[model samples]
Target: MARRKRRKTRVVITGISGRLGQLLTRRLHRLEDHEIIGIDRRFFRRRPKDVEHLRIDIRRKACEDLFRTKKIDVIYHLGLMHDPRRGSQEHHTWNILGTQRVFDYARRHGVPKVVLLSSTDVYGPQDDNPAFISEDAPLLGAQRFSQIRDLISVDMMAQSYFWKAPEIETVVLRPVHILGGVDNAMSNYLRLQRPPVIFGFDPMMQVIHEEDMVSAIHAAATPGLRGIYNVTGPDALPLRRLVGLAGKKPLEMPHVLAPTIARQAWMMRLLDAPAAELEYLRFAVTVDGSRAKQLLRLNPQYSAADSARAALRLGAWDAPSDAANQAEDSKGATAA
Candidate 1:
């Protein structure tokens, strides 16, 4: 008996050097019939097997040359840079001008589909925000934080392309805090014993496992599903209780002084989260995952609590009491 050959789908993934991008590329490659073309501004240290990695900034002329020659079936725009030192000229140049060039080229080059990775941070964490936010929620990302605010415009651009181009299918995934993976910045911060938190405003928090986030992107990349979807785990929990569930003690810090302290922390590389990120921890910004469930049929295997536990299970974590676990378990159940 001879092995039958499967038709390979030509998939192009940007930001292939990052953890999330690499995860998506690796998983997508597991399918026997998908060829991966990876593009990144920086070099990827560990190149995955069968992936055609290109170290060309999307804004550069070399990138344009590749776009001219390659026939891209679907372009995964996961190239947005999220760092403590974000909002620099380089960040803005790449995220704004860089992505615009890619989008324009994709459109002109007859790419039939696109998968964009946006963030829940686009919706600012307002004190009066609804407990569950849907895709229709207004994008009120913090104007004071250039890093986060820049994402809002990028997200808007992707959405506009989705509506404007009926010829191409575009699916945008707006996921909440992406945690529980070894390489995630947020997860590493939480893995430390006694992670910092706002003193008087421990608002509710929600997280999606790295696996779930990738799954949502996978679902969106499926042909014919073209729309914006809020992707998250099943449950949302109070920030204080979530810390408890993660088996980590919270380092209480006054909001007024947190910026100064967080700046030092960021400098030390102990906490990758900038002071601007504290607003999100202080105010709840939960997203409604109904659209993902209905359209993408994405059933997240990890709940909010599950994600925290996995992320904070590092050596520094303290074991919770049985009674405490029971209480947190109930809270998680109600959240679900």
Candidate 2:
């Protein structure tokens, strides 16, 4: 008698059009046994032919049908909004209500595993923060950066699922500042020809390569893994050195003037982030990845220098094509 072949794992990835999502899709696509289905409001350009891409909002009724019909093995909720440009109400609804819907669907459809990619920024940078923050640290990210509060809510909501749905494995990976060809605050900041740094302040920072972050998620997706874990890359380093590694000259601004300047620049659409975000430059928010290392078996594969170079490389943002323009225009029509 011949041995039986295992069935394919049906995985659904939200935000599959984003850079990090795209990277994860490619990685999982290589494994022929994983059937990939993407749920996003954005169009996935040049996606793998085998991967099914659905341009729909997670909060929509249609999205629920995907769960009701497909026997999904894992759900990767990466659709949380991080763009500060969006209105507060839009941001809150997308991150908070959207998360609630995902969890509800998993519970309703009996999905076994759900992985949420949260950021370590939820811990917030503080003047008196410990040298190595743990996953148990309080989430004060919204204290100064109000925009991050929605994200904190999402992370907390995911945590609630552990108790609310005990049978389902809920793994939340709070990775440090991820660098590489991604459209995040850190990546955008590094893309500046002259990055800004606060005068008289050089806080230590930790960053993970986009690939390493995807790797962490892969490790967390394994069977029977649950709970929150802090994922990090190489050891922490001073902000100035990290900036230098990105091949950009730091434009030092007095702490007093920096906030006002950032606010004004943000208002004029010159800066991507708000003034409160400067706290990361003045205070360290490094996290301990020992839990992930021991449990998820996650190991950072890219060096800080390698991550820096990848962030600065040509076309890091990958300019969108015409289809993307259409997607953007109609994305608001749906519940995101």
TM-score of each: 0.87, 0.92
TM-score of 2: 0.92
**lDDT per model vs. reference:** 0.78, 0.89
- Off by more than 4 A, model 2: 1-4, 314-336
> Which lDDT tens digits does candidate 1 get at residues 129-163?
89899999889886546577667878888888876
Best by lDDT: 2
Instruction: Indicate the worst ten consecutive residues by lDDT in candidate 2.
Output: 326-335
- What is the clash count for each candidate, in the order shown? 0, 0
